[model samples]
Target: MFAGDSDLSLTSIDLFCGAGGLTLGLENAGFLSVMGLDTNRDAMATYRKAFPDAEAVEGSIAGYDFGQWRGVDLVAGGPPCQPFSNGGKRLAAKDNRDMIPEFARAVNTIMPRAFIMENVAGLLAPRNREYMAEILSLFSDRYTILPPRLINAADYGVPQKRMRIVLIGLLKGSIDFPAPTHLPGRYVTSGSVLRRGETQGYSNPSKIVYARRPDLRPSPYAGQLFNGGGRAINLDLPAPTILASAGGNKTHFIDELHAVIPYHKHLWDGGKPRSGELEGGRRITILESAMLQTFPTEMEFAGSRSSQYTQIGNAVPPRLAEVIGASVARALN
Candidate 1:
């Protein structure tokens, strides 16, 4: 499948490829993932199990060799948003959060045609923006920076509402992030997914339920992310960024309706069932979380429950990754 358009059929190396969400997207975008590197051995296990052919190196990202790790299409799985996120503490650029420079240092050494860095919205906070600008400026000689965009996962087909910042860089020509396909309203509809024991998927338009017929329509998600007159959007475009702790972190959510899905009766244990107290719940299962990130069904997480959560949470949603990879692949021409 990846045999055609060799220049555009780019080879990829994913750094910090936790459970391969970004790699999954690049694979979908028709790139050959030659290798992946990550710190967590467990995430490496998950990544290797699903992609046995791809080489997955497990260890700290600091020492990864840029020369040995060269690829025509470069990508970063994540740079660890911990220092930037306000959830724990806002370290911004100083709190051991300055690894992106090292990441860029390696990128400069390898010098791929294009690359992308995904991060928390907090990276744009005044404290960190200067450093981010510095990194952008450093890359200016080689890459035409695509204006950083704050994208919501719901803007695409994702069932969740999560915001993320993406910086896309190209060697010469400017890269334009794709325009949002679905706008508010304009045929975007919200509906409820039935539990395993429930009757079926339905669009109670009065209740905003989309009905699934046994003969025709197939049910997607069984649980609903809406209540109190809010709803999930079925977008025609690619989904917003699938967050690392997307379902777990409620503070990142915009709509009250979306923030509640993780705790609610999702397709967990095959969709048997959440309480009202689940409002600020712990999190949803790793499987449900990965699904929201657009990983393929054939791939399974190979780790403990929490490891699975950590792996899925720390990933760049594959759907968004596809856009990034395809953009680079096109640029290679």
Candidate 2:
């Protein structure tokens, strides 16, 4: 893992901040976040529960003062991943995807020194590319553009191999790809990391390796954080990304390994062992999923078992937030 950028003292405002992944990454980087805005009630509840000190506003950002956000050093979020994913029905600027543009309006109003936008790699799809282009194009008229970089949580030490596009907007300079803190784990087959060292790609699009969209799910990631190559971060990496499915819900069905184990149901009921997994072809439990997302060890839920799961899944990985915060701090210093 990367040496923590501990001295950066920037602050941030998170938008469309479902579960707070961007918020968490920025916090990890050393930025002090003042607020997070999202429409989902449970998602906000979970964010507030974990980050009691920060203001987790539950609502659309459309009616707020984009101008009042000026003092912050950064504005960040992943928005909704589903609207642009190939696995789901693709929706670009038309399918409620216009929120991306709305997000831009927020950034324009607040005007941080730097802003970051992240979404599923499918956002890079030919048609959706224009929407991304439009957002950046409008911003570029006044700010330095970082273009857009695609990265995976796995490459950065998180066990799951989720890949997304990150757009960095600077007030006066450019943004390069963040340095690699970790590489692919040995256990996660080469197919998952990059097409067998092909690095770039050949004429046949599928033959292309590194450029291919990253697929989530690391091979057999049920155990603790162990990057055989010796990375320093935990299983969820610096901080885990919150899932849209997270927060106050864990109606899971476990695999026979967890189901037929003949062990007490209480143990796996809400522990860290089950995340993104299906037991007996059913969803995993609540508690385990939260731990996988790396919620603070002290965090607790006041509602039912599923309520607890919902909160965890909806929270921003505190670790990732720190990373973003650190970068902002660097610029401020």
Candidate 3:
């Protein structure tokens, strides 16, 4: 936790708050989360449950009034990123789902002492650069916008290699981005949080579509044996980015033996699974996914299995958020 004067305390409001990941982190960092806002029913339910003292409002951010929260010490959120996501159409401001402008509008209206916004790295893609410039202009009159930084959750001790762009703006104070707490070879690994023996009631992949075993590559990031967006996990290293599209064949696979099987052409000489060949593996469970995202073990997600996965995948790792929140709190103090 970032220490401040004896009476230093700050209040925050989280917009686009899905399942309260940022709220949880800020709370852990000594900020009082006064309110949360989101459109997903299940996500709002989870947020309300997690932070019962805070008011969790359910609605779209477009045209939402921030008049009542005019003096919140911090305003933070991850607006819908589908429009600027690499996997999406990249419509940017043209896409109806693009909520960056709304986020800016909220910041300008509330005029918080400081604000933090996180989104997919694709937001800085060449195609969306112009649109991003326009959004930054919205805060020029009131806040000093810091250079956006591409941050990896693993650098902050999250067990996944998820990366996102983080932007910070301050109305009248100076703040720096949080420094990495862990280095490359010292990263926390997925194996440290997951175990093969703990897969009792968790779901498994409908089918194992191994194109082939891992090749004799020199890099620790080499083994990608699955067919969909998912890949084979290197237990010794951080897991690949967890996707919101979980509970399907695209979900990441784990080698039960904890060994990366060597490439064997005969295993699938024709690019299809052999009739008599088999391997020991299973898709990661929702709980495991949450663990990888660095969510608290006892935090209950209120939704269907798929909705729960979406909540976990979409969350900013609470650990990473706490680091950022500490920095913001120090600036405020």
Candidate 4:
């Protein structure tokens, strides 16, 4: 397990702080999270439950006072990424959900020794390049911002192939991104964290819909196997990104008999199951999703089932965050 220097305890304030994923990771790295801020009531409840000692404040980041948090060693968050998410409208800067500017505002006001901003990889697309440049310009004068890097959660042992863009800014010194602990051939697989036959309470699709589009064909690596947004998961490999839209029919499905059925082949003898026929696969449960996201087994999420799924899906993957936090702690120490 990665451990930070126990002698030097750093501090941080999580801005978006959904369910305390980043906060949990940083705490594991020996940083004390003093406060967490967010707007979702359910997320705040989860965050509070996870970090009871830390103040969990519910409110929008916009117009919120960050000056009070001045001198915090680090200010970190994954701002709302709906604007740049591939699953969303891809509105870029035009979307009302865009919160990069608010994140920059918090960093500038807090003037922390360093700041880490996480967002979807789509932010780097050519269409959003100019908007991203504008967002970075907000911090150029105050901090030494590193070139944004796209990081894969699987590289850090998270059992999901989640990719995100991370931007680190330092006030004085340089810090390198954490090196991948697990390589391609040895990546931690879904089977490492997820258990078999744990689908008791979770719902499965009524009828399985196979992808007819050639472009959606399942590949050796990843692809859409079903018609819904859910992707097929290979037990021996990292699962595809667990989306925020889970807890519904769109949630990714797993087939214990994948080796037998394989790819797009039907479970029945000749064709797709009739309408209302129970699909022979199971969608992952809330606890299973949290486990796949690398949350502690004891971690309890508050709020509705949908909200819990969203919190888990939107989290930074505590394992990945811990790796990043360790790097940051090393730089600070």
How close to the true structure is residue 231 of candidate 3, measured as C-alpha lDDT?
A: 66
lDDT of 3 at 121: 95
Each candidate: what lDDT?
0.59, 0.54, 0.82, 0.81
Per-residue accuracy of model 4 over 129-212 as CA lDDT, tens digit each: 898899899874869888899989999999999999999998888888888999998999998866566563445443445555
lDDT-best of 3 and 4: 3
Sorted on TM-score, best first, the list reads 3, 4, 1, 2
- Model 3, range 181-273, lDDT digits (tens) per residue? 989999999989877756733676555565444332444245444556666677888999989987776677677754334433433344443
When 2 and 3 are scored with TM-score, the better candidate is: 3
- Flag regions of model 3 displaced more than 4 Å: 1-8, 211-224, 258-260, 264-278
Error of 2 at 52 (Å): 3.0
TM for every model, in the order presented, reads 0.71, 0.67, 0.90, 0.90
TM-score of the candidate numbered 2? 0.67
In terms of lDDT, the poorest run of 10 residues in model 1 is 196-205
Give candidates' CA RMSD values in order: 10.3, 13.2, 3.7, 4.0
Which runs of model 2 end up more than 4 angstroms from their true locations?
A: 1-8, 186-283, 301-316
- In candidate 1, stretches whose alpha carbon ends up further than 4 angstroms from where it belongs are 1-8, 186-284
Residue pairs of candidate 3 with colliding backbone atoms: none
lDDT of 1 at 11: 74
